[model samples]
Target: MSERIYSDYLNEYCKDSSIFLVKESEGRVKNFLNLDQEIPDQYRWRFSDLNSIVKQVRSENTRQGLNKIYWTDQSRNIEAYIIMTWWRGNELVRSCLNGLNRREVIVPAIAARSLLELSTVFLLNANTLEKNFKKIMFPPETIVISTDIENLVAKMIWGTRYQPKDELLTQTNIMTALKKLAKSPGTKDLMPTYDFLCDIAHPSFIGNTSYWSHIEVINPDGSERRLMSRLTDRQYNTEITDKTLWALAWSSTCIYNAFIIMRDAYSGLLKKI
Candidate 1:
């Protein structure tokens, strides 16, 4: 059968189940093939490595889900889907407990700890990627590490909130953390990535007049749904100085500590792994 005919047949077969899934899966495969065709010999190898990792992770997850999945193309074979059992449920439970008193001191502290764990993971990944990958387009820098942690903290805190205005205002905290990191002796060497980080931290036009601040997933079949909120005024300005970097780092560390405590309560889950 022709490629088009094969795709059409698959579409018809899976239409009742998940048309979107079929299309997205096929599209990813096609995009990867196109990249292999267009990229240089040297760069093609890197893309291949990345594509393999993507496929491996997806396959692992699929299998874990107990789904009888199949893939038509050999290069596009679907693998197991491994889902982490300990999800946001643990976080929500912790939040509920922490909401008992008006003081609400523990909840924020827990949030800070989670932020730190995430930052440390990113920092480790950055170092690993730097060492493993050759001819990297973006070199690893301490400034990048500081900026990334700041962004992560911003997302964790503001992204969880339901207010767009509040989310947009997170820039202040982000900037503060950056400045603190830059000033610290440990992070002083990352001064070079400082300017670049600042540029990305500034705000820009959101392009929509309507305050589409929140998102919802509604299942027509009366299934459970998930909702996510959106942040407005999304723009980055690149004028970060050493002072700004230091401040941002300090703010991030405070939040990171909070996140860690909350995560520690669920440390049993970590021990399982």
Candidate 2:
């Protein structure tokens, strides 16, 4: 096949501002078996199902007949879910940034936790794509295995949030899937960073990453703690503060890495077509 250029698709679909691209996004994520909860306006661009995504994006809204450009059958569900997870995570990160830019008062704990979750979702997407790509391209036993991995990854990704179980995917959890993701040239920082990300997401003592204070108390051993300080009213506003910037940096980098990996994987498949 001739070279397939997917740059435009990547650019339009992979960014954070994409949350603004929809009038509204709603549906029950059947993959997770979660109730069809309505999506709030802030999450207007998120979708967890591949079947619903095509109709909403092209046939339903744009009238652009682009459904065939994406996977359409049960056989390709894994590929579709991988893209959906990454894109959804991308938009989520972007939405948080947009809210920050607007100076909306946000709970840092919530923001930090959300960023941590998005990072994990992206990592999971990468793992899913790597594990199933060959299975996706072949036949018979490959298809069966690919389908199972795809569905399992799908359920694992959403199940983390929805808490429902799919009997088929329950054999192995998402943590296992994450561990199976192939190492990437640039993904070395993923897991180590994720360690700290968890703290920010959970309610651990160190996880309450907001309102820090620092007093350089040299102990009897002459050890000094990190130079941390609480944000004062006189400091550059919360959104621009060092802590907030670090959160944004972590979120954007995680999202971008996921996007690049997802984008490359899809582009490779497109070339095979």
Candidate 3:
């Protein structure tokens, strides 16, 4: 198979000023990608706009050049194609992680702690500002997680996968860790961060992966292979109460400690290396 070149696709999709290419330093690219939320709109355009631009570019490309090109639309609602940059050396790190078959790799303990701390700072700032000055009051309505929140988590997980010897950390583990950290006497200020993780870790908020199975018999001995069909449901049931809050707090703590242990192990290996 031929190697997939990102630049080739860029050339095909990026025709006019609609797609702006920003050059970023290697470290900055990783940092931007690992942030807990999507880069603000000031950083990128909406995905809808990007798609419109791509469609226009493709039509123009087809008429000018008869080159057969295949491309995949990996953009999400929170992503903007206008702010894309080519990170030449980053693919090696991605390739290394891909070989390990891990998803949402664990961040270093220090990094994780720092992230929580930063989140706490943001929440505290917002809380303080809101308390000091009354903002426009909005009526209570259904609380929906913003696309920014989902994209932020996805980017953080995606970037962490490239960390050396990173372990896959599930949403459950992350919640457990945050809860533990929150309960610590010294971590009172980080309560908001703990709550945020708990929200993401709730089973109802997580994606489901159950499906139907199909069997294919290959031998007279009755050996068979099972094929599963993908299915999706839109139903959601959530119960948020004092009891649930207490449970989430406890689970967060467990996850925090688990992450600490993993970090220590990784550090030990790094020392030897």
Candidate 4:
């Protein structure tokens, strides 16, 4: 098989304002998911526009769902399941964008990480559906596992008050899904931003003291040693805020692309069934 040249598809599909292209060898170009340089729009108007694109597609998906039922009992209700997942992803992206606009730090970072994982899973599920269109009785195992984990979490959280059913099973190892996404040609670049978001999302040094106010530590002899974190710094937290906005922008793009992939896959499957 010939190597997939992404520039052609990217140029054809992506908006010039939203994407930055880098020239590769042999006159080819690579898609860089963010702006080439920081635009004057520090409030991220362009990022908000990207979220609008996602929201529009989600609206279309809603109409499609209401138009007809795609998956049947024989198909194990895969269409409803996958489409709802995309809708949920849409809501997550909107919330992340809102948080970004509000200048929230940790919540947007955490939401960006979640959007990245959901976007990658949508791509993976689209691939599986395309390959196994005929013999599939259910969605991919990843989808099933993810749903089970979500249900289990809901049950575990509300089980005491409502006593939800025991639907708990194995959990999803996100690294596994991320590894698969890294192997793909179009999505490999997302890993770096995702890694950065993970660092901020986790309750580690980068997530805690790094974003907090620091006080100069004095040695016993009056010599300054280092800075010790005193409290969370909302006044001058540029690093975390800037990095989180960039990642959230990329996450928005990923969510849009994943929706398109899933939309196409659903269209094809609907034609077949």
Candidate 5:
């Protein structure tokens, strides 16, 4: 299927979800921005990284449109748009993450869409970073760690290069890589949740459960009738369930943290002009 706008997603998924639960998630987003803002040695590593990119982008551009991205033309500013999309994806996921947490009833419905966006962002950012690794100046360990994982995943999933499917945007490829990463010894605990969330996020039968219907009647011919209906009793005016609320906060935090390096590169692009 092709991509969809946000409202379409909301209308379909949020109808049976909890508004109060979604509202509760907004309060948690800010803490994701900074864990130790009051401390002497703050943990604002992402902030510093973003600032570096900003400085670089500013210095490189003699043209006023260093910041320009090919939003419509697609031909102009390809690199800029790739980087911008990386940021834009994060920004939207952040907002969507926040909006869904505090307002929707069935949080996973919204989560599926957010994860879809993040998955794309992941592919784009990783590929773009690799393409411009030298300019990004990422730490040797940082680069090595991700590449190592990709290589391991590729080998395991496809039996080495014989049946290569290394396309970054391929959902199976990304899923294999992410599942492997999440299953690593240190991350084992989250394996189930990660896989479950992957199901919700991926374009699969499970993700569309938001549109599930009631089977109230059997026709005279004994054919089943799956009528369009809300899971009304499941609705809530109460807080979002603990698990969902935490997931929203966690995903938003994850995206924000992930963008530090990429944002730095984006800023560098502006400077390089």
Candidate 6:
């Protein structure tokens, strides 16, 4: 597995429809942003705690070494990719939290979506390494599992860290990654939230029309009803803002957990090796 393209991965691992699960998820995405409900009191506390934890966890970036790593060049390369991946995820969590504080909707949702994607992929790779530490660390030239797994990890890191600004692209099929994330152990509950964030991140109905615009019922002649759409200048409706806050908080928490899990797993595996 020499880091094949998205289509090649799809062709080998997927069935006839590459976008089937993604399409299914799209229909399941809801317009909950328009719900007329107050923010939960517990969510307010959770949001504050999330902010504090994010600030604290962000301070751990300077600790880069594996303390007592003993591995070959290949393992070291993987370690470096994992470290950079963690940094990228941390940056996204901060960006999403900042957007939430500013009451920004679309951009924060976008950032949260990216954060979720990164966290999911990192968890995937980390879990794989944990289960097959010796196999992955001491990979042979022709082992299908090791190469494919390595390339998958590399694809995510490369897409985020190496792509040029002018021709930016992601190597992973986002929906595929998300589906895998949802099905993976300890992450099944995140599917709905991830789908909702996807709805907000894209320029679809809930993402744009319901999020950035409101409807007005105008009765000009008192005999007929006409509906009008008005832009909000990026201002969030009260309920929408609350929902976005929850989303950002939830995504930030997920990323933070991923970072801790990754760091510990990397260190633990290095010591074992």
Best by the lDDT measure: 4
TM-score of each predicted structure versus truth? 0.19, 0.45, 0.19, 0.52, 0.38, 0.53
Query: How many times do residue backbones clash in model 4?
Result: 0
The per-residue C-alpha lDDT of model 4 at residue 208 equals: 68
User: Per-residue lDDT for 81 in model 5?
Assistant: 36
Off by over 4 Å in 2: 1-87, 95-106, 134-145, 156-163, 170-244, 270-273
Candidate 4 on 161-199: residue-level lDDT in tens?
234244243334678878887887766457776887788
Candidate 3 lDDT over residue span 62-116, tens digit each: 3212111111112232122112211111222233223212212122111233344
**TM-score of candidate 3 against the unseen true structure:** 0.19
- List the lowest-lDDT window of 10 residues for candidate 2: 23-32
lDDT of 2: 0.43
In candidate 5, what are the lDDT values of residues 44-144, reduced to their tens digit?
22222336546655665433333232111111223333334345444554555545534444554355345444544444444455356334333322211
Name the 10 consecutive residues with the lowest summed lDDT in model 6.
27-36
Cα error, residue 144 of model 2, in Å, equals 7.8
Q: Over all chains combined, what TM-score does candidate 2 have? A: 0.45
What RMSD value applies to candidate 1?
23.9
Instruction: Candidate 6: give its CA RMSD in angstroms.
Output: 16.6
User: Per-model C-alpha lDDT, please?
Assistant: 0.31, 0.43, 0.31, 0.49, 0.43, 0.49
Predicted structure 3: lDDT: 0.31
Candidate 3 lowest-lDDT run of ten: 64-73
Q: What is the lDDT of residue 255 in candidate 3?
A: 30
TM-score, cand. 1 vs. native: 0.19
lDDT of 3 at 63: 28
- What lDDT, from 0 to 1, does candidate 4 have? 0.49
The per-candidate count of clashes, in order, stands at 56, 0, 12, 0, 25, 0
